[model samples]
Target chain A: MNDYHNRRGFLKKSAITTLASLVGTKIMFAENIPARVTPLPLLSDSVDGKDPEMTVLSDRPMNMEAPAHLLDDPVTPINKMFIRNNGLPPVKESIDRSAWTLTIDGESVKQKRTYTISELKQRFKPHTYQLVLECGGNGRSGYYPPASGNQWSQGAVHCAAWTGIRLKDILADVGLKDNAVYIGYYGKDIHLSRDAKKVVISRGVPIKKALEDETLIAWAVNGDDIPLFHGAPLRLVIGGWPASVSGKWLHTISVRNIVHDGPKMGGSSYRVPVIPVQPGEKVEETEENFRIIESMPVKSLITHPKSGAVLSSNRSLSVRGHAWAGDLEVTEVNVSIDYGCTWQKANLSAPKNRLAWQQWSAKIDFPQNGYYEIWVKATDSKGVSQPMVMPQWNPKGYLNNACHRIAVKVVV
Target chain B: MNVRRVTLAVAAFFVIAMGITCVSDLRNDQTTTDTTATTSLVDTLNYDPHSGLVVDTTLGLVVANCSGCHSTELIRKSRFTRDGWIAKIRWMQKEQNLWDLGKNEKSILDYLEKYYSPSSLDARAQMRREPLDDIQWYDYQ
Candidate 1:
């Protein structure tokens, strides 16, 4: 035993001691630490009320994404909602929902205002909207030389009906100064290192985005207490933007005179290159070269008749999916079965509300009995369309709103 | 039952073997009992199976430093060159308050680059090269 310990060069006892001290409340003794750590659970295993089919990328600072096939529902249920966390969630048992308080303050705020959860619900009129939240790095796996973060496919996006008070109403109550340029949020999630001073992730949007009618300080998702995993007591629900901007477990909102310089606001955290770079080129992360991603790009997903569907030669396939453009409306969606060689427009539905994803469907008749790929493309109100291939590769691989294609085998 | 007889026979054989070994070790004055207890504790305490870290020379360092805050899946899924790994470490130090690894940095980086470096041969890279051709195709209703 002594020899084994001696052979190991970097088993500094301080690492364990620090962790023990940090989680001292939960784990009292060193022996309490499990002797043998178990192997990674099978992906089929589910926890925290999430569906078993959802992919588990990492569990420590839990990050999970739903598979594309499972995302067919228009209003993504709490179980199906993708979870992307920068740090561990606050302990659910310890949270006092009624006593939860949200403070609005910053350099540009005329007056600092604090409201208990109950007070905010009672004083302000409630509104609900089906908001689409997508990770900035959604579809990151398609980037060549793959990105450094979670290898999310297309599952890191969802549309859920959020019920909460308008953020504009709260800002009006607090009174913003003329100099207000941005709004930054702070959440109660504990940092990974358990450093009290180190925030897990604090990001915010511009003041204009904050004042939009759909921007909300939401506490309910699909008309229930926000699940603990999704941010329980309170959270910000800014639609049509990177979900990171909709900070979860929200506790404080700061009206800033300058652009929000919170933890993830700087660097290449959620920013893309200002100019397109070669696929393999390395670019230094700088304010001059990289700019924060604002409204997301035009994107769509074919949710029904999931990829790799097998069908009889005579059967016509009915394809349906959802499309959304950040801060813009999806004007049209087209489907092609001949590998983009020929195209036909699909019937597109109006969004339930602004910033909500629009649904579309089309019946595709196969010309022969072989293999085929169904491709869907969406065009936004600004005349911007989804790229056939991935957008120019940035260093961080932020946005890849390429047309989503699925496969089908037509058997004779 | 015959099963009970077989179980008793196996148990008796192990008991006899252990008795002989213990008696021989006692005569040899080798502290065999102490060694057995130590071995059991080491087996239970030393390794974490769930971390998903490839066992290597720097496994101790990687576990001590990296797994404390996040799962090793983050490392397993990521592919980076040596400089990229260094940049990640620096980011953690600057933003995450990761303590200076000092001399152990080289070993950790070496282990990571050896095992986790970007390669076109990885499963994910292959996935990019070809859409999943092996997935079980289901009948469309």
Candidate 2:
């Protein structure tokens, strides 16, 4: 045991020395301090049959994310989709597909209307679109001086074919009053405390976004009825915006005359800086300094040659990834093999759906690489490209679209 | 200056090596007894099987009150000041169906503040990457 400790200590010291020499810094060691507190076992591990690859940030009010490498599919599988919930999910026993009702009301509605799940399917034309739904804090772990929410290291996003009625069609049929400005949504999921007054989550988008052709009151994902965790029977799927705006276990839609200030919509909850701030600088959460995040920026992820992957030196490597822009189409994707010193265009596949992510792949010859990094950058139809570094610092760490970097080693 | 620094570093390393040896000898003598006591203490805590939440006697009340509705993970994940925890509790009582703690509120606040206080700015900054040193140029043959 003593020898084991000595050997481990010597190895750690040697590693520090090498790192210090490479970075040209004097490394100091602290005694008795554990290098890191043991991270808790993922909550998914305890579940009967959950995806083992997911990083579980919390168990109750369950939040788990699939690692970026596991999310390489063009359409994210239902079982692999990330889960983010503000409150406890409704019990399985309480779910009654036939009895589910969606109530539409508010001062802005000329006449309050309620529709059952069956009625919604019978009354409206069903449209299907492949849409992306991403959490506002998708890449929050990359933020310096880490933010307060789940430290999602990307992969808090998924694109799936949604089968539902257009939200605009519902708004038109219900007859929106002239005063209606914002569309608020409510869900059946309750707070863990069973507090009668506390709402788990209630959020919405502006009337214009609510009326978009792509916005939907979805009943199905990936050609199947939405799973319970992803919101079963019925849920709102507002593409292009943060998934929070697309309330799950959806039951109510309220047309308000003012911007909805429901839970998770107030203060700087889902808001980002209006103008870029210095990295790691603190800024007060004020209305003028920040705005409610909308329309995500163009982003790409390198799925192949995942960070720390080993490749053969002699073989030509085929790098592949996925790219998407919120609401807008991704026009170009470029890969950098030499730390952005030079860029090579990658072939982008046509998206299967209007709002779906496009797959891109490129082949490159490694020039006897010791260590190599592949960077992927994407641009939207609006000509907005992802920044090389994080855009700005925000209190809650929302809307991070920094270019993705993947490190790989080539072995002879 | 470089030579002097190297010599000092070597001397300091030897001193640390000697110190560790002395400590290791003492630790080995007590290892068996210490391991048993630690195992018993850990067992007594009766950590939540699902969430791995440590619920010692000091925090047993919190586990009992909070875990009935939500997993202990929610409470463990949150880091807040005394006021922040109070505000959250009040918010839960007002909005969510959390019942008033009544007299136990102060104890809850004290426990939460002790265990889950907001990390200081310096502590957070220490987690940031140090600025990269200037690159030394090398000639490739």
lDDT of candidate 2 over A1-412, digit per residue (tens): 1111121122244444454564356544423212111112212333333454565666677888876777888888886788998887787678898999999998899999999999999999999988889899998866665466776767898988899999889889999888988988989897877765677889999998898888999999989988888887789998778989989999999999998978888767898777777664556777788788888889998887546566653546788989999889999999987877899999998888777889999997777857677789999998899887765678787888888877666775
DockQ of each: 0.17, 0.12
Model 1 lDDT tens row, B1-141: 000122234444544455344332121211111111112221222223345444445778998998777877688668788999999999889878788999999999987775566642233333232343324467776
Clashing pairs in 2: A194-B97, A195-B96, A195-B97, A196-B97, A197-B95, A198-B95, A198-B96
For model 1, residues A154-255, the per-residue Cα lDDT tens digits are 889999999999999999998989999999999999999899888888899999999999999999999999987788889999999899999989999999
Instruction: Report the Cα lDDT for candidate 2.
Output: 0.70
Model 2: residues with Cα > 4 Å off, grouped in runs: A1-50, A275-289, B1-70, B74-141
**Alpha-carbon DockQ of candidate 1:** 0.17
Error of 1 at A158 (Å): 0.6
Worst 10 residues of 2 chain A by lDDT: A1-10
TM-score of chain B of each: 0.57, 0.51
Relative to the real complex, the DockQ score for model 2 comes to 0.12
Q: Estimate each model's TM-score.
A: 0.82, 0.76
Looking at model 2, what is the TM-score of chain A?
0.87
